[model samples]
Target: MIQAAAAILKKEITQELRTKYALNTILAFTGATLLLILFTLRAHQMDPTPKSGLVWIIILFASMTGMTRSFVQEAEKKTWAFLQLHANATEVYLGKLIYNFLFLLLLHVFTFFFYLIMMDMAIQSHLYFMSAIIFGAASLASVTTLTSAMIAQADRKGALFSVLCIPLVVPLLLILTRVTRFALIEGAASGALNDLAALVGYCGVTITAGILLFDYIWND
Candidate 1:
């Protein structure tokens, strides 16, 4: 399983490096969204609540746009059948999950920096903020990866991806936004630990469920 996952991961990383399709699209969309927000709110001072909301909003949509390519590309290129011949469903899912998680972490980091720079948002607790980001990204990756696999053969993958992903990811986004808000406020650490725990639980559950169900989805 480990070797299979590693091989798949390497293949994915190499393909991504070669084409840069998902990476490029995510960066472009994120940049344009941030720029639009910057220009729209240039004169007004924005509060952290809405700023936090906006950050997750951008992440949600940007991730929806890029992460769907995980299995979609495979299906499009007819490589999914090749993978099924050589690899177990669990290995394929884990490999894709890892790739998506890493991709989302990088995307979030880049977007956060630009969001802070352009929107002038400040974090009071860097520790809590980074923790929220890590778990949040993981949760997003887990859910989207499974959903991508589930919808890979659908007629309208793009629309179905968003439709399926939104409800599944909403709970995670809510907890993440709350934790991030706590990270931003000076004295908002009261519930930070609890919220962080919730985020951790959410990530764990999503990944575990994906592991259990992915075989059925992939083979179906």
Candidate 2:
């Protein structure tokens, strides 16, 4: 199963390199949105509280632009059927989950870095802020990966994906906002200890459930 997962992961990477569809879409959306926010809202001059919220909002929406591609692309490209046939459900899910996590983790950091540069926000706890980003990314990735699988076969994938995903990630977004506040406003890692724990717990639950349920979802 592990070997199969690795092969799937490698396939994903190679396919992404060949196509660059997801990466390009994410970059375009993220850059354009950041530019709009910087010019229109003057995010750099916004209040600290709102700035933290803005960070997550941008990251989440920007991710939504391309995160669904992992599965949707497979289905569209007619590779999903191949995956379903050659790989067992668990292997496919794990492989997809890993790719999603890695892509999302990088996307979070990229969006955060651009936001910091554009906002000129000072950070006292780089470690804590980065930790929060990691946890937040993982949690969101886990949930979206599962939801993407659920909607991969649907016709109106964009609308249906958003409907299924937004409510599920609300708790994650709230926790992320709290942690960001602590990192950017309170400037204390201690202030966000509980939120960080919550993020970890959420990630564990979602990933575990995803692994357990993928076989059923895939086969169904």
| C-alpha lDDT score of every prediction, in listed order | 0.89, 0.86
TM-score of each: 0.96, 0.95
Model 1: lDDT of residue 156 = 90
Lowest lDDT block of 10, candidate 2: 187-196
Question: For model 2, what is the alpha-carbon lDDT of residue 122?
Answer: 76
**Predicted structure with the largest TM-score when compared to the true one:** 1
| Model 2, span 37-93: residue lDDT tens | 999988888888999888888888877888877688878888887888899998998
For every model shown, the clashing-pair count is: 0, 0
Candidate 1 per-residue C-alpha lDDT over 15-113 given as tens digits, one digit per residue, 9 for 90 to 100: 999999999999999999888878886522677677777789889999998999999998899998999999999999999999999999999999988
